[model samples]
Structure formats: structure tokens, C-alpha cells
Target: MNNFTKIQDKLMEMGASFVGCSDVEAYLPENLKKVKYAITVGVRLSDFIIDQISDKPTYTYFHHYRAVNTLIDQITLRGQIEIQNMGYSAMAVPASQTVNDLEDRYSGVFQHKTAAVKAGLGWIGKNGLFISTKYGPRVRLGTILTDMELPIGSHVVRDGCGSCRICVDSCPAMALTGNSWFAGCDRSHIVDAQACSEYMNRNFKHIGRGSVCGICIRVCPKGFSK
Candidate 1:
């Protein structure tokens, strides 16, 4: 097997529910442009915990979210190491982190969703979550940017959320704009991040340190099929 295929297999064995590679040269900053390829890793959240969510996030679901993020980080870190051992450069982006330097407090060092979507693993839902075909928005994602040349998936250029307003209607914060997503669409067209953040902080702070609310994720009908 090729080196990339071997790495992919190893990541799956390490507990990644989904993995994809993407050519994200255009998305990288000037200094980091050398590593144009990205390896995206996703871990499916527990359907039982996600289904337990109603209007607010349960403590169990909150813990599950953090735990899944930690797992994804571990998987991506291992993938990065494996790539480096193959004589290539790699950097594993954190599973979930807010970069203060960016105008968007919700922004990370690199957006995992970007890599995920470009990898054809999912699309951006109206609620601003990565909507996976198999798990809807109930999946935590991690990414490893690398200089290693690997086969990449076809870029998903269109949104899959056609006429679905469940997440928008279910959002207590009224943060969702009910707009469809496109490859280059602005996030403001689909969700009000500030409103979503404030609403969670105001209402569900007692549950998960006010960092989570899963109403939109629970309401999404995609991935519910057995």
C-alpha cells in the first residue's frame, strides 16, 4: 500500500470514524503555504447522548463533546507524526480552539470544516456546523496540514441542505438565517455566531460551562436513518 493509504488506515484504526485528504493550498497562510494538503479526521458523537439533547445541552453531551474533541486531537496528532516519519512536514490543528487574533472568536488556527468539506466528507449546515452524511452535525473534527503529497477527494462544491429549516427553526437564539450554504458563501449568510454564542452562554451556562447547546444538532434530520 502507498504511504498515504497506510496513514489513512492507521488513523481509522486509532478511532477516526471518517478520514479524508484535501488540497488546501489556497486556504493556507503565506508562511504555511508549503503544506498544501490537509488530512481531516472526524469522530462520530454518540447518538444516545445527542438524542438526549432537547432545548439545551445535557451535561453528559457536553462531556461527550469535549471527550470527542480530545480523541480527534489524539488521532490527528498520531497521523501528523506518521507523516513526519515519512520524511514530510505536518502540523496537527487542535480539535477545538479559539484564536484570539482572528476577528472571529469562533475561528481556529485552521477551520476543520473547510478541510472536511473540501475533502467531500460533509457540507456546512445552516447552523454553522459541519453536517456529515452519516452523522449530521454530531461529529467532532480535527485536521493535519501537511506538505506530503497524497491523493485527495473531490471537492464538494455545493450545499446539501436544500429547503431544510429544522435547525434554523429550532435554534432558540434565532442565530440561523435559514439560508442555504455554497462553497464560498459567507458564514453571516447562514448563522449569527455572536447570537449563538451569547444565547448558549445566557441559557445553558450551567450545563457545560455555557460553551454548548445542541438543539440545532439534535433537530437535524440527516443521519438519523438507521
Candidate 2:
């Protein structure tokens, strides 16, 4: 098998259900230049516990994203060491934190959006997030940045979301960044993040903190039941 086939087999062996590598050069933010390849992975998080956590109305529940990230880190660390043996540099970057400032984010890590796009995971939805072909937008994303010049798949610029505006209609905050967000019309139907956050907080007071309402996720016309 070729290098990609070998890596794909290895990722599967490491428990990665979705694996693809993309050229990280163009997607690399200006501040981060050492990156050459982005190996992407997605773990299935569809479970009843996520709903149970929402039902409990608390933040002390198990979020599968953490486990997914840990698995990605472990696999990437091993992959990096293997790449080093092949005379190249490799590193797995951590990407499982809420943006504190939203300004310092995406500095050096490969563009998760573009990386997913090239990897044939899915198209960019109206929410400025990647939608998985198999899992839709429910799955979380992570990337490993490395100096290893792995082959990149084709760039997916065609949009699958054509005229379907369920996400646009369901966005409570109107934070969808394309037709509404790109137009800079943030004062109208636009949801107030503070207000939206406060609403979640209010729900938390009654049920659970940081519970995912998933109205938008449910309303989305991708894969999965609303």
C-alpha cells in the first residue's frame, strides 16, 4: 500500500472511524507556518447520555469530545513518532477548548474547516462549520499538524446546502456567518450572544448548566433525527 493507505490503516487501527489528510499550507494561519499536513479524525458521539446530560441540567456530565480528543492525541503522538523515524517532524495539536477571546484561536493549527473540506468529510454548512457526509454536523473535528508532506485529497468547494435554509431559520442568535453574517447585518433578527448565553444559564438554573439545546442541530437537514 502507499503512504496514505498505510496511514489510513493505522488510523483505523487506532480507532479512528473517519481519517483524511489535507495539505496544510494554504489553510495555515499566517502566524503558524511549520505545518504541512493535517490529518483529520472524527469519532461517533451519538448517544443517549448526551440527552441525559441535557435532561439533568448540569455541567458535571461526560462529554465524549474529551474522549475523542484524547484518542486523537494518542494516535497522533504515535503517528508523529513514526513520522520522525521516517525523517520528518510531526506533532498532534490540542483543540478542545471554548474560545476565551476568539481572537487568539486558529493561530497555528490547520483550518479545521478547510481540512475537513479537503478530506471529503462534508461541505461547509451555513453555520461556518463542516457537516459530515456520514454523521452530518453532529460529529466533532480535530487535526494533527506535522511537517510530513502527506498527500492531500481534492478540495471540496461545492456546497451541498442548496436553498435549504433550516439552519438559517433555526439559528436563535442569527450567528450564521454566510448570508446573514457576511452581510454585516448583526442588529436585526441576530441573536444576542449574551442574551442567548443567559437563556442557557437560565435553563441551567432549572435543569442543567451548559446543556446543549440542539434546536439548530435538530433543525438541520443533514443526517440524524431532529
Candidate 3:
């Protein structure tokens, strides 16, 4: 098998529910621009745990979210190491992390959803979550930036959300703007990060220290349909 296929297989064997590669040069900062490709990994969340979440976040769902993120981190870190052993440079972005240095408090070092969409694994939902075709928003994503040249999937440039506004209407924080996502659109056009963050902190502190509220995830028809 080719190196790319081998790496992809290894990632899946290590617990990734899905894996896709994308050319992400445009999304990378100048310092890391040399790493032109991104390997995206998604770990599907527990359907039972997600289903248990109602209007508010549940302790079980919160724990499941953190557990899935940790698993994704492990999978991506292993993938990164495997790529490095193949004589290429790779950096695994944290599965879930908030970097305050960015103007957007919700921003991470690298947006896993960006890579996943570029790789055609999913589209961005109105709720600003990565809506996987198979699992909907019921997935936690991870990414590895690499200089290795690998075959990449065709980019999905169009928004699939259409007229759906379930997430927007259901958001207790009124954080979602109900905007359909398109490539290059600002995240604020879909979600108000400050409002979402503050709402969770204020109301859901008992669950996940107020860092999570699964209302949108639970209400999404996509997950239920699957």
C-alpha cells in the first residue's frame, strides 16, 4: 500500500471513526505554511449519551465529550508520530482547546472543522459545528498538519444546511445567527462565540464547568435521522 493509505489505515486502526486528508496551505499560518496538507480524524460520539442531552447539557454527555476529545487527541498524536517516522514533519492540533490569543475566544490553534470540510468529510452547520454526513454533529474532530505530500479529497465548497434553523431557534443563548455556512464566511456570521460561551458559563456550570451545552447537538435532526 502507498504511504498515505498506510497512514490512513493506521489512524483508523488506532480508533479514528473517519479520516480524510486535505491541502490546507491557505489555512495555515506563515510559520507552518510549509505543512501544506492536513489529515483530519473524527471520532463519533456515543449516540446514547448524546440522546440523553435535552434542553441543557447532561453530566454524562459532558463526560462523554471530554472522553471522546481525549481519544481523538491520542489518535491524532499517534498519526503525527507515524508521519514523522516516515521522514516528514507533522503537528497534531489539540482535539479541543481554546486559545485566547486569537481575537475569537473560541478559536483553536487549527480549526479541525476547516480541514474536515476541505477534505469533504462534512459541511459546517448553522450552529458552527461540523456536520458529518454519516454522524451529523455527533462527532469530535482532530487534525494533524503535515509537510508530507498525500492524496487529498475534493473540497466541499457549498453549504448543505439550506433553510434549516433548528439549532438557531433552539439555542437558549440566541447565539446562532441561523446563517448557512460557505467557504470564507466569518464564523460570527453563523454563531456568536461570546454569547454562546457566556451562556454556557452562566447557566451550565454544573455540567462541564459550563464549557458545554449540547442543546444544538441534541436538537439537530441530522443526528436523529441517522
Candidate 4:
């Protein structure tokens, strides 16, 4: 009925698995502090492609990964345009772009999981990935920060990965720290980014150019449970 509902409905119609909104003022940089709200969009990855992963990423998985990221970008861009048409300011964060200038080289302009968690769609997994309540870690996220005041999700989902170390044990890079994620906890506590990056670059260059490794996603019990 309202603008938020209209936008959310449109995004879901565009193939997004989930669409959520949250107040993310505290997580913004000074330049983006004006856009205090975030719209979190998630697309569930293919079970067939994800299942193909064992110890390393497959060529098909790499292509699938890029395709999903591109899809997320398109969806968020359309969402951003819709918000602007509604007389609000919006910026679509890239689905997978890394900036070397950031304090964390492995991160994007903003963490999609942060917004997704605040939106109550999911929690951060031990693998440092967003584990959707419905889809587990098999979902990729996109975000659109805006000045619009949208209704936020009330139920903040807690870490459901209690004692699950399957992803940790399965990581060939040994990048996972077996640490559970809590709101506001640093990413390093859960993953060794440098180690993970180096291992992938060294071994999986033929697949996704070492940019992707879905072993953790494949071994995650949460995704296969439902």
C-alpha cells in the first residue's frame, strides 16, 4: 500500500528470495550517514551448483557466482531508481566490489550481512557469510541505502550456528576460525581473510580466478536441513 511495500513487492517479483529494511545509521560512514536506512535484498543460490563444490570451486560455480552478483546489482539498481522516483535519495551498493582503500581490504563499501542481520533476515555464519533463516549461507545479498523511512523488521535473528563447525573443518584454506558471530563482533574473529584469499588465489585460479570458493557453503548443514 505504501512506498516500502510497493518497492519490496517489486523486488520479490524480480526474483529476490527476500527483501527487508533496517535502520543502519550506526553502520554508515560520515559521507553516507545521511542515508541511514538500508534495504537488504537476498537471492538464494542454486542447490545444484552449490552441491557440486567439494574442496574447491567449480567452473560452473564461478560463472554462477558472477551471474548472481550481477543479478543482485540489477535488482538493487532498479530498487534505487524506484526510491528516487518516490522523491527519496538512494544509493545501490555494489553486489561484489572491493576497495583497497577501506580499512578492511576484503570488505565492500558496506557489509550486506550487517544490514541483512539488522533487518532480521539472517545472522552472520561462522564462515563469515550471511546465513539466511530460510536459505542458510546459500544466499547472496545486495543493499540499497536511502533516506527513506521504511518499516523495519522487529525480530532480530540471533546466531543459529551453535557449535556447527562443519564449514570450518571443510575450508581447505583453514581460513575459518570456528568462532560464532554476534552483532558488532569483528569479522577477523570468525575468519582469517588474508589466509583465505591467499589460499584461493594460489590453488583455485582456474575457477572464478580464485575469487570464489563454495566449499563452506556446500558443507553448511543449515542449508541442507530444510
**Reference-based TM-score of each model:** 0.96, 0.72, 0.96, 0.97
Q: Summarize candidate 4's per-residue lDDT along 1-226 as a digit string, tens digits.
A: 9999999999999989999999999999899999999999999999988998877889999999999999999999999999999999999999999989997888788989889989989888889988899999999999999999988768778788887798999899899999888777887899999999999999999877879988989998889846
Q: Best candidate per lDDT, number?
A: 4
Off by over 4 Å in 3: none
Predicted structure 4, TM vs. truth: 0.97
Q: What is the C-alpha RMSD of each candidate to the true structure, in Å?
A: 1.3, 4.7, 1.2, 1.0
Candidate 3, 70-92: lDDT as tens digits: 89889988989999999999999
What are the lDDT figures for the candidates, one per model?
Answer: 0.87, 0.60, 0.89, 0.91
**TM-score sort, best first:** 4, 3, 1, 2
Task: In angstroms, give how far residue 164 of model 1 lies from its true place.
Answer: 1.7
Predicted structure 2: lDDT:
0.60
Of candidates 4 and 2, the better by lDDT: 4
lDDT of 2 by residue, 16-122 (tens): 76888777676566655676678887665554433443223224223454566677777777766766776776766664545555554323334465677777777
Which candidate would rank higher by TM-score, 2 or 4? 4
Q: Is 1 or 4 the stronger prediction by TM-score?
A: 4
Candidate 1 deviant stretches above 4 angstroms: 155-158
